[model samples]
Target chain A: MSSDVAVQIDRVGKRYGRHWALRDCTLSLPAGRIIALVGANGAGKTTLLHLAIGLMPPTEGSVSLLGTPLKPGRPQTLSQVGFVAQDHPLYRGFTVAEMLRYCRKTNTRFDQAGAEGRLRDLGIPLNRRTGRLSGGQQAQVALTLALAKQPRLLVLDEPVASLDPLARREFMKTLIAAVAETDVTVLLSSHVVTELERICDHMVLLRGGRVRLAGDIDDLLAGHRVLTGPRVDDAALDGLVTATHGERNSHLLVRQPATAPTHPRWEAHPVNLEELVLAYLEGQD
Target chain B: MLWVTWRQHRAALLTGLFLLAAVTVPTLVSGFAMHEEYRAAGIAACLTDPEARAGCAQLLDQFTAHYGQWGNRMIWVTFLPALIGAFVGAPLLAREFENGTWRFAFTQGVSRTRWLLTQLTVVGAAAAVLALACSVLFTWWRGPLDAMSSPMRTAAFTVSPGLVALTLFALALGLFAGVLLRRTVIAMGLTLAVYLTVRITLEETLRPHYLSPLVRTDAQKAADALPPTAWVVDEGLITTAGNRLSDGDERKILQQVYDGDTVREGGAALERYLAEHGLRHYTEYHPADRYPIMLIIEIGLYLGLAFALFAAAAYLVRRRTS
Candidate 1:
């Protein structure tokens, strides 16, 4: 683990009765970096998120946050880790202003002015109850609360799932700005890799409860490329490693050091965030 | 903190107050039929006028109509205060976790335990007050009816104050349940079942001590008409405490004193005697001596049960998860 890493998991695993939610997962998230965790449905993304949020304990292995062992029933881990849950599970009855006050009263760290400013910036009523707001607005309110906390690490679980594309981008802008202002570490999970690719500096691709890939986005994308063309002999790509292959063209996406491939029989194109994620997941199965 | 709960829960709290107000419907209208019915049953039978008898019967009908459904109403209304508590108090923690707003508190440099406790403090305080207000209203609604007939109120006792306890009970339980369960629906269900089941059982079954302490019945009154010596042969037990212990029952004369023990249960009723030279032995005792003492005993028993359950609930709350 890096000296400045905010969170570290050592072979963590979780289970529900006979079924396993997560198995043998390992990763380290350093401070002041935005990491996007991508996965498919029922892919243990939430189980890992729960661990990061300190809402649950791992059945196997240990998860450390801020250099302390993660524990439940106490919120000590919360000071460093801010969690923004999916769907913004807010009190339906409390107006935005009341919600803000609730936030301030229950949490000494709440910045009233910052929360108010965020609400104002979003054009949401401080007096409007969350239940009465549009889905996008509710998401914004949740994001506002997460931002106002100014935490050391902000953990967002599908935080923008309920927002429209425009609102999502707008919310992400506000979120990025808030994290920038506070220098809070960001670890967000999403199925939409492209959206995360826009603001996130690093990425963790999760498949079958393991870290398929984890590193800086630039380093990861630069090292991998989709090699699609007419069928080429494996001997022709002797220096490259195939990451994924599609049967239709026997297409090979390869990851190699930044070296020029002069073979004309194959096409080498840098993979986009979506293509990288798809290739990773496709390779996992 | 409480203000925030009130701010969010005002509507539900008001609704509860209104429901408590509605509970007075029986007592408020009871007077219309109660006065004459009390006359017909307790004083004299005034069946001469058909309209008057019908009115009295109608009054009696109200009490009997709800006898079977009484227990069920208590269950349905269990959510009355719980709604205020669970929907209001539960969101205290789960909402933070759900919306990610909890980060705001953590970022403020507050320790997580202090923050959770603070929310519990603020929200729990608000819920306790609202629940108490609802309880008081319901208690008052039953007050006049309680004054009307002690027995009916005995059955009525099974509801109002018990419901009040369940209200506070539900709020605290809901807080813990929602935390442990995480999902709102499951938490609400678990809380309602745990709190009200205990409330209902305590009121109707376990604490009531339903089997008669003495087994006295109208048939026993007829059996009391037998001679004291014949009563001794038929009755297995008797009580002569009034003859010895009560000052009023002592009249400086001994009618009969051939008992092995001081007295036995059933035989005591047969020990009655007409005064010889105006002498009295346990014949003129008034039960008023037991009234004030019994009232305190009854209230103590019920409230004691309530207190114990509530304390257990509070202790369990600190263990609540989310």
Candidate 2:
């Protein structure tokens, strides 16, 4: 595995009882960039994140983080990674100060004042009970805890799924600010690709427990073209990802070296990130 | 890890300390008064001096009638250990799982084994200390009453230092239930129920078998007074032929010998009838001096169970998927 890769999964599979949550999955997340993980519900997005963090071990294959093998609950691995689970779970009864102290004592690399300062900037009181905070404030505190660890790879599983539009914007603002201040590789999963189109530089699209598409976002868009032409057989297209055809006409989303098609009869249009993701997602059906 | 554990459980720990103070204050106050009353009644002198005991019986009876009921009421202290388990131990893990906070806790730099062991050690040690404090307080409070009867009795036995082991057992049982059940209320309820069952079963059926009861019989001195604090497990009338007589059969024989007359009405005739029958009283009892040895045995037994339970909880945590 490349030392520059933040997370590397090799033929990893996770099974819950008789059902496979993730199977035959392999990906290398590049360092120091925001990567978006997209999939439908139960499509194994959470399972992949959990495996990457060493929260749960893979039944079949191996996963490594930051060039070292992933071992769940290991001090070294956990110190290098920060994870924000789906609900952003915190101790409801504890005051914000107590929670900060808890993180400080439990983690050797914790930045206590930095976390408190983030909360302070957000106007979140240190003595306030965690349960009393709004959902947005709670999400910020959870993020603060993760950021305070000074992790190399930060894994967030649907951090903004439950937030309002304003909260989502604020969360993204804080995340972007944190990214700008530090060279942290972020991998976040979300259902809406449009929201991530501008923020994420890379993408991993999953469907039915498998990686359907994964690459640099700009590269993926630049390599694919939407060609409108007369009906043609599968042999006519160089790399067909998805196709929509009528009796007399056809529209094909195909991956190639450039944005143009070689055939004179075809008209090529550059695909956007949303269209590219949608094509692969629809192709799964 | 220590700060985190304390921070997480400070509220419960403080509340426990407050409760200890609450119980200890009253015991201290009432204990002093009861001791003063015992001294005024001269029960200790009466107990130690055989000649004075006969003269002080009426006075001792009055002291017991006034204060013995309080000793009976102290059985409630036996349940405090279980209560401590429910409040402090059950919530140790169950609350995290119930509120989905285990994801945050276990994902930290600390391993699950360290997390669990630290919590159990800190909380279990605190519980043992609290139980020890309560035991010392209640045992001191029961000193006069214990002198009146015996520490071997349930009312006094359950509050002795031996009960610290039972408290630790309760705490471990609560932790195991919390991990197994994963619901705070249900785990607390089950811990209490299970702790009570174990206590009752041990006291009633198991404790007596810890050692065999000693038997003593007298033929000429059939009516001699036994030690006042010996726990008499069994007593019977034996004939010269080595055949034991049931109480009912002995009563029947006395009735036939007296020709339906009451023993008080024909005391000399009753004595002559008993002599002619060659009968003597045989009593099997656990000596009161064995109290410390029994306490040590029970403490060892319950502490063994507590440590085993703690180890089981740690194992479950290490292997748990959630």
Per-candidate local distance difference test: 0.60, 0.85
lDDT for each residue of candidate 1 in A214-261, tens digit (9 for 90 to 100): 888999888887777765455346434443444545466677645655
Compose the digit string of candidate 2's lDDT tens values, residues A1-285.
Answer: 223899999999989999988889999999898999998898999989988998878998999998898876687788788889888999998888888887888888999878888888889999999999999999999999999999998999999999999998899888988888677899999987777986899999998889988999988988898888888866456688888888988888999867353788788888998888889888744
Give candidate 1 regions above 4 Å deviation: A1-3, A228-249, A260-269, B18-153, B159-212, B215-220, B223-322
Model-by-model DockQ, in order: 0.15, 0.64
Poorest lDDT segment (10 consecutive residues) of candidate 1 chain A: A235-244
Q: Per-residue lDDT tens digits of candidate 1, residues B31-83?
A: 44544444556322323343454465655456445432432353345566557
Chain B TM-score, candidates in order: 0.50, 0.88
Q: i-RMS values of the candidates, in order?
A: 5.3, 1.1
Q: What lDDT tens digits, residue by residue, belong to model 2 across residues B134-243?
A: 88888888888787676788878899998789889998999999888889999999999999899999999878767888877765444326767877667877887877
lDDT (Cα, 0-100) at B144 in candidate 1? 32
Looking at the true structure's interface, with contacts defined as alpha carbon pairs within 8 Å between chains A and B, what fraction does model 1 recover? 0.23
